[model samples]
Structures are given as structure tokens and as C-alpha cells.
Target: MSDTRLKISLASDRGMIDAALVVLGTVAEHCSAPLELHFLGHGLRDEDRDRLAHACDAHGCALVLHALQDEDFGDAVQVNENIPLVAMARLLLPRRVSGRVLYLDCDMLVQGDVAELFELMPQGAALGAVRDFYVLDQMRPGSERPEKLAWHSKVLGRSEVEGYFNSGLLLLDCDVIRSDRALMTRMTDFAAANDYRYMDQDYLNVLFDGRVFYLPQAWNSIWGRDRLRAKTLAELTWLPDAERTPATSKVIHYTGPNKPWKSQSKLLALLRGRLPALMKWRRAASGRYA
Candidate 1:
């Protein structure tokens, strides 16, 4: 029983397998603590799983791959046009992993010691996450899409002042999560009945609602949002601070469709002035260790 061990969970569709590898490689490089990585994915080819096992072995981390079933999540696994069905696998993490688990989306690249986050648990909070600035952006007046923003309050059963949290990075107390069957049932039921713009994120906001412990923006800094700091400040609460730039950010969430896994030139264009940070993610995502 090593005190420094961190349990991590990741869920990916077949298409995002490479993205998963890059994330693991980056964590292997930067994370100072030991790790136990559990991956929940559907129909992963043997070779890819073998490769992931080898990657984890090289990093001195243990890896487990669980075959995912749609039925396992009930109606909660319903399709979302915005995200792959597998992305919802995070919903099952507490039931599957058994103890405290850190759930990270495959699209993210970590640069700091993840152990720091793994050790933190807010008093009496079921989940710890960063606030979703996109929620605030959409909720603001004068935004073109009123319908999307309108649901935040309706779905969460609270006002926007309570804040909506990003599901990309979560530090979950699995014991607490497993104890609450009603919360899980409600989230699944909500997912089945409603079509949400942000997919499982909406359900999580509704599930955790006011209970989420908000972590700092540096912990789950969104790539595009952090870069947009030069443009305006009012709507971007998720932006990383000047001192906690990409180099210092513990987690850089490559949110949205334009990812660093794209070709170098394309990434350069997409990231524009933020290429230096993009270069780091690109290198990690590509598995170019040299």
C-alpha cells in the first residue's frame, strides 16, 4: 500500500485510442507518483490494448482494461450528437473502480504532478471539478443561443449563480458515489428524457448540482479558452493565470474538436499564437519522447 499511489480512470471510443496513449505517455513523463490506470472502452482491438499495456508497463504503472457494455449504464448511455457514446463511461467509474478515482477525458495532456490532485478531497463533497466557463458564457445575456443557456438552471434545479462544472476532469470519492444510488438513478433518468448540448456534463451538473467542490482553472485549463485571454476577460473564468501558463498547468484540457493530435501544421494554425504550448501537447500526443 504505497501512500503515493493514484488511481486514474479513462474512457475512450475506438477512434480516440491514440489520444489515450498520448495522455498516458504525458502523465508518465510528468507525474511523480505511482499510478493505477483503469480504462473503460468498448470493442478495443487486442493490439491496441496490448500497446496500452506496454506503454503503462514502461511507465511503471499498472493498467486494466474493461470491456464496456451499453447496458451497463442503462439509459444513461444514450447517444449524444456532440460526443461519442463511450465518452459517457465516466458515469460508471465510481461503481467500477471501488475507491477514490480520478477521471480524466482522453483528450487532455497533463504537465504537473497529478498526485497533488489525487490526494485532495474537499470535505463532504462527492466530486471535485473545475467550473465550466462555457456554461457561464452561454448563460450570459446577449449570447445567441438562449435555449442552451436556459437549460443550465432548469436541469440543475438551481440558478446559474451555483455554477456549472466541467466533467472533463473529476476527482471522485467512489465510496460516496456508490453509496448514493438515488443520485445515479436520477442522472440516468435525466439523460434518457432530455437531449443535452454538453452530453454527460449536463447530467453530472444536475446530479452533483450545488455539491461539487470547485477546483482551480489551472487544474483543468481548457486550451482554447486559456488562449483567448488576450481577447477578453469577462466571460473566461476557466482561463489559466499568467503564472500558471500551459507550462505550469497541472492539466490542459484540449476541449472541443480541434485537438493537438491533428497534424503539426494544422495544430499550429488552430492554436495560432499558442503554438509553444501546442507543441508540447503535440509532442506528447505523438509519443515523440526525444
Candidate 2:
């Protein structure tokens, strides 16, 4: 028998708990399959956990929370102030969860039936993700930041940097990730040993590299400042000649420092305009979109 329930995972701290719920709720509204939800973090208020559990229960899904202490990580890796230790909690998930898990950052917004992602598999790969728009732009000819291109190339450890993927949305093969603990450990070690800029992103991209199945941009439609030339998965040269990104993006991942809740921002309008499904879901959530 095939167990097809979608297992979704997320990690965050007390600070982002509210926002994570909003993301999770929105995902649930749009996703049709039975869900197995997991949240890993510390400092969450009881209400937060209760709210999450209730929501999942209402939808008939199991929600698991792993509460941790600061010492739990125990200096596993060093992080800049911008990214807290909780960012590394994802690496610990292989031991904590089983099967293929879709690990999403709390900052994302879902606009499609995410269950559709399961139709694709990691194959021989450890995970799946979308190529970063910013990284690809940086590697282009006469790019504004040649140093970034050089650094990304160095981090990737080969002349080819096109395969580099964004870690914001990962379709992780936990079986593979669990089996490759030694290699995954090296990812954390590299972050601790160097001035790694992108936190977990650097860890995954550098570690998984060629081992990732680059999913469609629609699954992780990057909402960046650059207005990346390729919006849909089919537009990207790497994808097959089909509607991968789709006319309407499946997910819209807001990248960079300026997040929606940071302040009154124009992105809210973009969200309202581009994704009718999200707008309806957001209306029911009632102003959490801010």
C-alpha cells in the first residue's frame, strides 16, 4: 500500500510563530491532500501550539511539535545575528521525521495546490528545489556583482553555478538525507568554519549541489526585486517544454530583507492582485497577511 499523505515540515522561533501559522493555514486552505504537519522550534507560547494543533485537527491532520532547548544544538554551527540557531533545526529533521517532507520557510505564500508537488519525486537525488533567481542573475554576463558570482562559484566548487538552488522550499528525501548524515554534518561544519552568508541556504546548496532535482520556478516563484526574466518553470532552460511554472505561480516566495509584515508595504497589493485564491484565503485569515 502507498501512504500518500503529504508530510509538511517547518522550523521557526517564537518570533515567527504567528507568521508561520498564517503560512501553514494558507497552505492548508489550498492543499487538498491529507496532511501530516510538523513544527520544530523553541519558545513557542502554549496558545501558538494549541492554535496550530486545533487547525490541523479541524482539517483531520496530525500536527507534531518538537520543543528544544538552546543547548540542544550545542554549538553545532555558528550563525550571524540575522539568522538564529533555529535555522539549523531543519538539518535535524531527518532523524526526527521520515519519508519525503516538504520543508517550507515561514516567509512563503502558497497560491496553488501544493499536493501536486508530490506527483514529482526526488529520483536518485536527495531533494528538490528551484534555482535562485538572484544567483542566476548574478552569474550572467556583466552582472552588477561579479564578486558574488565568483563567491557563489567558489562555494559551489566548480566552474558551473547554474545548478545552484534556493533552499526556501525544499522537497527533501528524508531517507536520503538520513543516509547521508556524514555529508549533511559537513554542511554545518562548513558554516561554522567560514563566514557563510546565506545560512541554511548555503549549507543545502553547497551540500546537495548536483544531488538536487531542480523543481519548477512556479513551485517556488521568487518574489524578488530583480523581476527575473523567467517567471514560469517552462521558461527556464533547464525545465522540459511544458507548463511548469504555469501562468499562475504555485508559490510566491518573498526573497530579500523586506518582508510583508515588516511594515505597511506594496507587496500586499501585489499579492491581492496576482493570486485570487490567496486573497480569498487571506481574507478569511483576516489581516494576517500584513
Candidate 3:
């Protein structure tokens, strides 16, 4: 079997860092691969680095810190949030490493072993993305007709455009990413031109389009108000002592404003209760492995 690694990018911002640590810890426990937590952007304090190192130690994961100086990229504009951070990581892909790297947003949690995701990489595509559930009808101005949002489905050529895919979770083929300069340039250019809603995600859809393999919805299952109304609470809740089942998804992405951390929704509260315990498990597992 090919070696696999779990990769993520984050800044030193406290909230995002804390969230990243929690998710990283969760991923470490669930995945057997070497975990590579790549820290990008600025303000990463020594103490923060130490804390991350300690956490990685406990989990037996290999942690790599890539301090990206401003000079690394020529004069590209930068967004401090998840979008640009993700784009930066993508730009640095296929690093001197072998096999594929799983890039996950800091806001996600791994519910089960994601080693299987590495097996899903398409031979010709640079990466795989999940269609964004939120873009179904909100792509255009509210006053404009709903049909405008459907433009992708109507006018977009299968080769140039397809349904919008969320950029939060991705499985990138390092060889394809490193060899295809045009693909990287196009991703960068698209982000520069259309710096609007969805950020990197919108640009990614425009760049890769039908070229990307659409992974099953379960892989990037997201939670939001719409999901709450659509599925029963029992369906989304993660129970303690529950064995890890062979589910379709390798990760669960909390894509929108309503995260399990700050949500007051009834369903969110129930899921929130399990987070502390998961964190505890991560810490313990990290210590044993480190």
C-alpha cells in the first residue's frame, strides 16, 4: 500500500488554532497515517508551536511547520481566512513527498479513518472536490431570478464548468499538482479575478470544473440549518462508545456560520457535548504515541 498523510493549514490566530488542534487531535486518533499539520501565515507564537508539537507528540503524528514568509509568493493578494490559507497549501503541493496528501479545512472533524480517501484519487484529475450544498440557489443577487444560480448547470461546458464544489475538503494527487503549472496558474488567476462569495471554492469550481471527480456527499457531509430540517437529530449525532463504522465519508466538514462550537440550535448542542470527550481522547492518544 502507498503511504498516506493527513495535511491541514492554519494561522496563529487563537480561535482558528484552537479549532485546528481539536480537529487535528481527532484526525490523529482516527487515522493511522502520519499526520502533517502545516502552519501557514503569521503570529504563530513559540508557545503555540510548542503546544502543537506536544499534541503531535502525544498522538504519534509527524508535525511539519512551514513558516511562509511574505516573500514566498510574488505579489499575490492574500486573504487571512481559510480560503487563502487553503490556496497557499495547494500551491505548495506534492512537496518532496511521495503519494497523495489529504488537505482538510481547519473547521472539519474526522469521524473515521480517512486512509481510504487516498485510494479515491483519480488518475488524470489533479484532485477531487465535493459539490457545495449551499450553492444550489444562493449564487446570484437575491433580487435576480433564481435561474441565475443555475447558470453553471445550464451554460457551463462539461469540460470548463460543472456544479460548484466546496474547497474545504480535498484529495490532491501530488504528481498531477506539481507537474501541471497551468492548473496551478489558473487556480491562482481565478482567485484573483473572482474574489467574491465562496472565495477559493468558487474559483476552484471554475478552474477544475468537470476535471475534478465528484466524491460522494457522505465524504464531506456538512451541517447547517438546512441540514437540521432535512435529517433527524439522531442521524447526525455521534455517540460515545460507538464503533467506527465503514461509512462513505472520510471527513465531516462544518462549512457555514453555524458550527458545533457556538451553535445554540438543539441539534448542535447535542453534538457539542461529545467534542470535549473527543478532545480528551485526542490528547491521550497523542501522549501514548508521542
Candidate 4:
């Protein structure tokens, strides 16, 4: 029997409609379970609602929308320029829904059945997620920066290097999250008052700490891994060869500001978009020629 329980949640605002369309459209195309998307949008227009609903309906799925605003986050200071205020909306999503939910970022595309991740999830974690590239990069002695690691540890208020997980793709155990209201409150408060480089992402990592189920890197494969400074994939000795690209990744996350949807700009934009692709090729060719 087809699993009827998979529910995916995501957040975005009006400004990110184009990327939202791409992500939602792909989810509709690839999901194996009954499609139910719970979305949080701040200042969304009626026209945009129709567009999102259509993105789901195009593949015969349904979307339940929850309109959001800054006040929804209470005293939290919203000040990130690279992402919309709605990006923090996921912090409150567990209370809004029941059962397990897979929260996805709008900058990604689903290429396989994600329910497999739930099967892979271990017992007792409030959530499951892949470790961020920063965590992986930290494992490399040459790339390690004691000062930067210290900054992260200070920000997290915990020194667990493995605790960091990319918030882009989350498999949440809503019941567990709802039960931990005190931690949630403290995390939100800290995120509001402090300077966390990754914003709400850092807030979650700190609060969850050892409670997270470390997911396979394939489930949240980053398309443009900016942290990888190596000239070739082989030089990524810290990473398994299977993980260098989407060899088995079910979702391709286009992380950072330079999205495929955004039109090109100058130096910064150009480097974020093209350099990763070039490095992948150079790494492969160098191995072949050598």
C-alpha cells in the first residue's frame, strides 16, 4: 500500500515566488505519497496563492496555506538581507500541524521519493537532518580554523562540532518538538537577541544539540557547496567519493543567494553560480588524466 502519511512543510514570501514555484512544482512531480504541503507565507498576494496552488495542482497535489507576518514571530528581530523574513517561519510550523513533517527550503528540487528518509530516521530524535557542509569541512585539518570554530561554538553555546545540521531539509517529529516548548522559547529568544551567522538555523542546532538524527548527506546534497575550496573532487579527502555530487542525492539543494532562478550579476554572483560546476569537472578530469 502507498504510504498516505507523508506531509511536507515549507515557507516563503512573495519575493521568492519564482523559486517557490520551481520547488513546489518539482515536489508535485516527484513525491510518492499523497501530496500535502503546509506553507507559511508572509505578505502573500491572492495571485501568488493561486500560483502556488497551481504549482501543486499541476501534478495533482494540494497545498494548505498559512498566511504569516513579522508579528507572527513576536519580539524577534528580523534582519537578514539574503533571505526573506518568512525563512524563520519554520520555527513555529510544528505547532501548526500534526504528525511528522518534512520541511523543505524553497531553493531545492525533489528528484526522488523522500519518504525513504523517514524509514532511515532513528528512534527518539525531535528531528532529522543532514550535517551542514561547514561541519564536513571542519573535519578537514587543512580547512579547520580554530577562531571560526570557536565563534560557532560560542554562538551555539555548545562545543559539539557534529551538532550543526543544514536547516534546508528537515524531517521533524512534531510531537517531540511541541513537547519541548521551553527549549523552543529560549532558542527563539536567543536568535532574536544574538548574532548567529546562519540565523534561525543556528538557533535550532543549539537547542536540539544531541537530539538530532543525523541524516545521510545524499538526502540534502548541496548543488553549490561553497565551503569546498579544493581544486578537484579527489582533493575532498574528507568526503566520500559518492558524496562529491548527487550520485545518490534525492534532493538537490541550491543553497546561498545565487539561485538558478535569479538573473546573473557581477563577480559575487558569477563565482557562486559557475565555480562549483567548474571545480567538479576539473576534479574529475585531473583524476582521469593523472
Pick the lDDT winner. Answer: 1
TM, every model: 0.82, 0.82, 0.69, 0.80
TM-score, candidate 4, is 0.80
Judge candidate 3 against the unseen true structure and give its global Cα lDDT, from 0 to 1. Answer: 0.56
**lDDT of every model, 2 decimals:** 0.71, 0.69, 0.56, 0.69
What is the number of backbone collisions in each predicted candidate, taken in the order shown?
Answer: 0, 1, 4, 0
User: Least lDDT summed over 10 consecutive residues: which range in candidate 3?
Assistant: 236-245
1-290, model 1: which lDDT tens digit per residue?
Answer: 45457888888867888888777777778787788888997778888788778888888988878888767655554455547778778877776777777888887888777777755565557898877756555544355355666677777765544368889999998788778888756644535534666677877876786677777657777675564432333444444453233333678887766677665575565546556567767766554521
Residue 69 displacement in candidate 2 (angstroms): 1.7
**Model 3: CA > 4 A from native:** 1-14, 71-89, 94-98, 136-145, 148-162, 189-194, 224-250, 263-290
lDDT digits (tens) for residues 1-290 of candidate 4: 12374778878887777666666666665666677788888898999898777767665666789988677877666567775667788887776877688899987766677767777776567899887866656656566566667756786676657457899999988877778778656644634633576778877777777788877676777775534533333455655443455445567787766665555454654566555533432332242211
Give the clash total for candidate 4. Answer: 0
Task: Compose the digit string of candidate 2's lDDT tens values, residues 1-290.
Answer: 12767899888888887667777876887898878887887777888787778777766777878887777665555556656667777766777888888888887778777787767763556788878767666655544465667867777787677777877788877787768768756644634533567666776777786787777667776654314535322244454543244645677775555555554445664654433433443454575432
Assess candidate 2 and give its TM-score to the true structure: 0.82
Which residue pairs show backbone clashes in model 1?
none
